[model samples]
Target: MKTLNTRLDNAIKKLYTAFHNNTLHPECCKQCAVGNILDNSDSWKHFSDEHGSTKLNYVGRVNEAFGKRFNGYTPSELLQIEVTFLKACGYQLPIHYKNTKPDTPTDKDVLFNGLQAVIEFLCKLDNNLNVMDYTKIFDKIKCDFIEKSPVK
Candidate 1:
């Protein structure tokens, strides 16, 4: 029999792929919960460096309001959440090109690995996860953002 962790991991992978393929929503990223957090945080540089100061400031304010919910998660766990959230929201992980040496993995490769780590962590967090469990987590994340997000 498969372990609960294995089941959850499989479910999250399926959901992540569905989200990535736009089977859920085509424009989900524009209003994504985790995307909003990353777009507003200093860590956004890890994904994209093109944001202007004003946009970054806006992201900062958003983070100020919602960052506390993620206080205990490790950086890697946070990255997983961000990647999962982005995929579920119908967005693509940005392809960073900083370490493309022959032996090193590309940005896409790193992101894929990150996603796998996230699945493992999430699966371990709950032993009785269903496919909708991640969606519930996503909803909570979204609710936190919507509740604390500043006015446009």
Candidate 2:
């Protein structure tokens, strides 16, 4: 079995390799990338308020249950993974906004525009590119180890 560090290094290597060799497929058309997730985010925020306070009062159970210090994946990483699939079917994604400024796109403003682009691109993938399949592979990369120290 590979050590956690080795596994992490390999994962990072793959991410980097994919980055360096990023290949955009032919143009497909506009579609949703994370339309479902965005839609669910609303439902979750609403449900947590009205009937189930589960998500709102996540407190600490979420950490124990999901095994993360906080939210598991970073914005860019998440966006990248979302794009990877739809790109396989020749979809062009909008440049992700990664800034903090209100009026301008920042180097770190990875939200709305990024999400919109991803969704649009995703709406065009071939039926063969199972979203769940790519999701599992991406999840594995993010969840690579059983933390060395649980109480950090």
Candidate 3:
């Protein structure tokens, strides 16, 4: 049987890649059913072929939008609830903040505990994890972390 920790790790991987690596475009081969369920039309942004800078629209979280509908929302006005939620949950934008900026875990802490906190926090939501699994990955990270600990 698969452990919860592994499951959580998988969940973190899913969300991380979804945010940082998933490609977006209008003409997709993947089947999308969320638009029908949410009853809102999708707006696909056009690409600038010169640089491939297609500012495609992300399909933001539906649950968050539905929650807002009761608090006064219209399909015409889109609330960036997913990004808002991640910001609230301490998920840093641009990712560099986690490594170099204030209001975040220092490199030492990340080497020891920060990544676990990230996984646990994200797992509390739609993620497929809880917290303990981070402990396991920590073992794998510790060797490199200690080896590369900045001596300053």
Of 2 and 3, the candidate ranking higher by TM-score: 3
Name the candidate, 1 or 3, with the larger lDDT value.
1
lDDT of 2 by residue, 24-51 (tens): 1111111122222332122222222212
Give the range of the ten consecutive residues with the poorest summed lDDT in model 1. 47-56
| Cα lDDT computed for each candidate against the true fold | 0.41, 0.31, 0.32
> For model 2, where is the 10-residue window of minimal lDDT?
23-32
Worst 10 residues of 3 by lDDT: 44-53
Error of 1 at 41 (Å): 6.7
**lDDT for each residue of candidate 1 in 9-126, tens digit (9 for 90 to 100):** 4445443654464332212333222333233234443322331111224444455456533333333344455555444332444423451222322234443453444455465556
Best-to-worst ranking by lDDT:
1, 3, 2
**lDDT (C-alpha) at residue 103 in model 2:** 40
Runs in model 3 deviating more than 4 A are 1-7, 11-106, 126-129, 133-152
User: How well does candidate 2 score on lDDT at residue 70?
Assistant: 16
* Clashing residue pairs in candidate 3 (N, C-alpha, C atoms within 3 angstroms): none
Error of 3 at 103 (Å): 11
